[model samples]
Target: MSSPRQQHWENVYSTRQADEVSWFQDDPTLSLDLIARSGISANAPIIDIGGGASVLIDRLLDAGHSALTVLDISHVGLTVAQKRLGDHAGRVTWIAQDVTAWHPPQDAFALWHDRAVFHFLVEAADRAAYVRALDRGLRPGGFVILAPFSLTGPERCSGLLVRRYSAAMLQAELGADYALVNQQPQTHLTPAGNRQDFIWCLFRKSAT
Candidate 1:
């Protein structure tokens, strides 16, 4: 069952180049900076959700973080990334699954980074499920970093509707078990030569 957003992303990756995506960046420095500043172990496992075709994975590998995973619903996007990374493909694990249905491995990632994924949930149940999984999947005291369309950001992407969220709104959606640590603004350059704003937030899992 392809979600509307999933279909939209698959179509985008099938027809557009990496440089044509709104989230495309030669270096997603803002996200990487937040991750590095989180005081987490450099070698701790990190997973990038909806990481399709993002250069962040390349940057992560270049930074000496060996345990990295990229999960995306688009096979074409993953293919492009594999081709771009070349021999380095062997170093990163790639999983093709709709994140809402995927389960985290036992004792898995220490950090989870998701940009522009959760906003597409649109439904309370889906969003709740995603957060529930995040809470359960992350190791105790692990970190979760996410970026979503701001309340003032674009309402659509690649011809599909998107739900926007504010920092507080998103934190509430994740519930009280996760503590919101940091929030910042990010400007995204779209392939069509437009800029969009996103709110990036970081959360830490509470022992409770």
Candidate 2:
């Protein structure tokens, strides 16, 4: 059974080259910078939510992260990423599941990273589900690098409505167990040469 979200993304990946997508980036510089600032070791367990066909996996594998998981709803997107990785694909654990509905492994990831995915949860219930998953997925001392459209960013992307956020808004939404460690504003130049505003937040799960 194909979900509408899955079908839409499947078409997006099938009809467009990975780099041809509007959100495509040759090097995920902002993401890498935030991850580096989190101070996690290269061998730390990490999950890239809604990773799909993003090249973050390539960068992570190159940097020697051992426990890596990439989860997305679209099978086409994941298949393309696996094909791009070739033999290196075996090094990664790929799960094709909707982020809002999937149950994450218990305290499994040292770091959880999401870009553009959070903003897409326009419905309050979906956003709540995302937070629940986050709380369940990360280790107590783990870090989360979340990147979403800022309040000033586009109201819609890829034909879907999005809920933009500031660092403060994101913090409030995630609740008290996660504390904001660092944040940065990014001006991303999409593959189509359009500018998109984004806020990247680094949060640590409280040890208490």
Candidate 3:
């Protein structure tokens, strides 16, 4: 039996066209740019949290990134991406699991990227669990690129409440072990032509 969180996303992906979703982005330019700014090599291990049907995976693969893992709570979402990728899908690793509950291999990733997922953790415990996973999965000196709803963004999305953040708030959540490197505010234009505010932050883990 799927968890409520998993079931919710599975239903969303199963019923909606990928490109028609509210969070859908055809280019994913900011994500790609942040990945480039991380300075990791093409072969470095990277994981995309809540990757779902996002085309970021497709862009990464096209850029010669070899070690890529995409984790989504929804199996249906993963399937959508796989179908879109076809033969190229086999090049990436797909894991269907909740971000807070999943256990990652220690020091397994060189870079961790999340876009619009962290904000969904409305509870303190859930946010802490996500941080724990981040600490365990991301290697020392690794980069973290997080794009969550800005403080000015919407209070709700997809029938769920979200916790918005500024760069300082996000840095506080990550704590001192991760140093904030850069931040950019984005006004995202949804498929329906509505604007959503996002705060993108890049942090590098302490090498010690």
RMSD of every candidate to native, in Å, equals 1.5, 0.8, 0.6
lDDT tens digits, residue span 3-79, model 2: 89889988898999888887888899988888889899988999999899999999988988888999998899999
Model 1 segments beyond 4 Å from truth? 1-5
Provide backbone clash counts, one per model: 0, 0, 0
Q: What would you estimate as the lDDT of candidate 3?
A: 0.95
Per-residue alpha-carbon lDDT of candidate 1 for residues 116-204, written as tens digits (9 for 90 to 100): 88988888887877876687678888888989899889998767678998989988898787789899987888768898989999998
In terms of TM-score, which candidate is strongest? 3
Every candidate's lDDT: 0.86, 0.92, 0.95
| Per-candidate TM-score against the hidden true structure | 0.94, 0.98, 0.99
Which 10 residues in a row give candidate 1 its minimum summed lDDT? Answer: 1-10
User: Could you tell me which residue pairs clash in candidate 3?
Assistant: none
Better of 1 and 2 by TM-score: 2
Q: What's the CA error at residue 183 for candidate 2, in Å?
A: 0.8
> Which is better, 2 or 3, measured by TM-score?
3
